[model samples]
Target: MQHRPQNWILILDFGSQYTQLIARRVRELNVYCEIHPFNKDLATFADNPPNGVILSGGPSSVNDENAPNINEDIFNWDVPVLGICYGLQILAHNEISGSVEKADRREFGRSELIVDDNTDLLKEIPEESVVWMSHGDHIKELSSNYEVIAHTDNAHVAAVRHDEKPIYGVQFHPEVVHTVYGGQILQNFVYSICHLKGSWTAKSFIESTIEEIREKVGDDRVICGLSGGVDSTVVATLVHEAIGDQLQCIFVDNGVLRKNEFQDVLDIYEDQLHLPVKGIDASDKFLERLKGVVDPEMKRITIGETFIEVFDEAIAHDDSYKYLAQGTLYPDVIESISFKGPSATIKSHHNVGGLPEEMNLDLIEPVRELFKDEVRNVGRELGIPEHFIKRHPFPGPGLAIRIISDVDRPKLDILREADDIFISELRKNDLYDEVWQALAVLLPVQSVGVMGDERTYEFTIGLRAVTSVDGMTADWAHLPHPFLAHVSNRIINEVRGINRVVYDISSKPPSTIEWE
Candidate 1:
């Protein structure tokens, strides 16, 4: 793939949990960046060298016998460099004059940062600001040519910079939201030190993506599984533009959709997009197979396998379509392929695994390189309505995961009704766009309640809404009490079989956005 010259940043990942966020932050600045493994060969680096390079945070200790190491010549690549977290420790232990030592007290959360001297990196940052630290090691001895620019309460040498070179390192993570002025620090490095010209935009991405898709799927029929989410909608639109009438979208309603979402989405594809969309009603089939499954992983595997079966069966007699296009994002690919990050397998996405090898379908993932917000931007470029582009994200397995336990029609109905009510209230209060993703999870346990002076045993539901820049990390939405009370009351009173409700207040590091 060809790209514009001198507008990209090369980020080498060292297995940090926040590595993806670094790329997201740079992209948010409208500057292009690419991530490669920490041990990527020097030739790959020489082939398309970026204007600047970034060393990402990692979990491995620099003193470990099998620690990940980079090319020593990267320090002499002439391009500016920024090392973060473990990256800082690596530099201290190797290139610069500093000794890495395990801290007496490990810092795991927010801390106070005091700037000893305002350097180029901390140009406009406040003298006393907050930062997020998650390390058990710190720089004990500073190099002769390096100076401590900033320090936090827990770590004395929180940040350091080279006196002559454009190389800098920070012990704390600036990619996360908990760190104050994190974006500013990155902007200072990207724009001030590297002098990057923010030239990337959604329009240019769409044009290149469309042209690539056109060349890839030349005169061949493509079948895409449309889940009615922004990712798939935008992907379908892009592919449709590339090869008109050659793309046939199949929407499989596994009977686990939002209330009236099946028809609503079908209407959007037929009436609004004016494309060839086939709606497959496989609710009964799915429910029949999911009769007594309780484990979440099993549930996901079942849904994914069943979906592939449905798609294969639908296209068994019709053999024109030869490609299966999915809306698999970059994070999905990273998580599915590697177990090197801080967090382990939180959960398996339906599209991530469990497909039989005999399916014989070539995948044409148009938007796999994008994140959720980027997908929305592409949707806007493709002339999709703002309302559709802004819809909250929904998982591929649908209400099956949200139900949390054995599947049934009554449970699906109750969850769907409650989810619909919760979403309606969010939109009525104009709080939909403020959230990244929101959904109601149906708990397995039931609760006792008194309604109309009668004792009743009903199901309990949990409402989850989170604010996130990308789906990689999330913080629960701090919905107002009045709004929560209203939505809770509506769910308990209007929707039968759901009497009790609660809200999830956990962040992504501790809890995932979904219950299952």
Candidate 2:
């Protein structure tokens, strides 16, 4: 992947979800950057050089003997360098030592960043600004050459910088929104140090991505997996516009969809968009393979494996197809940064996982460079419908993860109907778009209830609706008591087997939006 001699930055990924976010922030500054594995050669960057470099946070602890690390040459690259989270830990280890591990007291949430009032890094930020900290280890000691530039209540070395060098490190994750001065910190690195011009926008990304797509794909046919999610839909649309009708989208219905989702997705993606989309109704195949599998992890693995088989078989006859286009957004790339380290939440969302190793085709990830909001901006540029652009977040596993206790069709259908009513009422009450995501889960727990003179034993359905800027952290939607009452009544009255509905009011940390 040889990028042009443009204003480029290189993001050294240590497998953190914030890696792509780091790149997105850079690109937002109109300075193009590419993410590479830390083990990749750092010297090639000497000639076709990036203006600066950033090291991404990872899921691994710096104290772990086998933790992923960047080559030391990164510090000597003669350019500005920024290290984040595990990136900071690795840097501290490479130079300094004794970053104490506090596994029992990991800094996993918001913290106040106590910065040196005169420091350049905290240029625009206040001295004691709030920042997101998510690491288990802290710098107990620093290298003789490095100095502590920032601190927090718990960790003395929240940030470090070599006095004589351009390299810098921050223990807290400045890429997340929880960090009050995160964007300012990133801007200081980009504008003040690297001096990158903030000229990049969604328009620029679209034009450049289109040109790149045309250059690589040429006359070859490309097959995209359209999930009807904003990321995939935008990617499919952008590719179609780039190559005209050469891109074929194979949408597989994995029997884990929401109520009437199969048709709704097709209608919006196929008919409305006028793209070359083929709806492969492989619901039965997926359902059969998934029978009696109740474990959430097992369900994801099986669904991912079977989806490959289904997608592979669906496009096997199209001999001209040589590339697989995915709607993989910046978050997807950032979230699965390690490619090996699974998410902390254990909830497999936004990922279909990696394709089979022997798929033998190149991957076309058009929107892989844009964030969720940036993708929507590009969608607006491409004339996408506002409703489609602003739709609520749905898990990549579809409805499989929402059903708490079972994966049977009868239970799935019931869950789907109950979920539809819940969401529809949210819409009718003008509260749908306000929430980040809303879903009804079928609980395995059964309870006795009386309805119309008969006693019934049925599963419970839990409803969750949240409001968030992105899926990273969310707060429960504040429903008017009357509205909640109306929604509860509709689900219990209209959807059978669900005599009870409970609303979840927890945030993302303690409770993920999904029940399972």
- Provide TM-scores for the models: 0.88, 0.81
Per-model CA lDDT versus the true structure? 0.85, 0.77
lDDT of 1 by residue, 1-516 (tens): 233335688888898888889999999998988777887675765766788889998888887877887667776678899999988888888855338878899889999999987768988899999899999878887777788899977788888898888889999999988999999999999999999977778888888777887887777788888998988888888888889889888998888888999999999989988768999999899898888988878888888888888888988887877888888877666655553433456666778764555675788787666778888888898999888888888988889889988988889989989999999989999999899999999998888999999999999999999999778888999999999999999999999898899999999867877888
Task: Give the TM-score comparing model 1 with the true structure, all chains together.
Answer: 0.88
Which candidate number has the best TM-score? 1
RMSD of 2: 4.4
Please list the residue runs of candidate 1 whose C-alpha ends up more than 4 Å from where it truly belongs after superposition: 1-7, 40-47, 71-78, 96-98, 104-134, 143-158, 161-166, 177-180, 317-320, 334-343
Tell me the deviation in Å of residue 509 in model 2: 3.5
lDDT of 1 at 267: 98
Candidate 2, poorest ten consecutive residues by summed lDDT: 340-349
Deviation from native of the Cα of residue 151 in model 1, angstroms: 5.6
- Name the TM-score of candidate 2: 0.81
lDDT of 1 at 377: 88
User: Cα deviation in Å at residue 326, candidate 2?
Assistant: 2.3
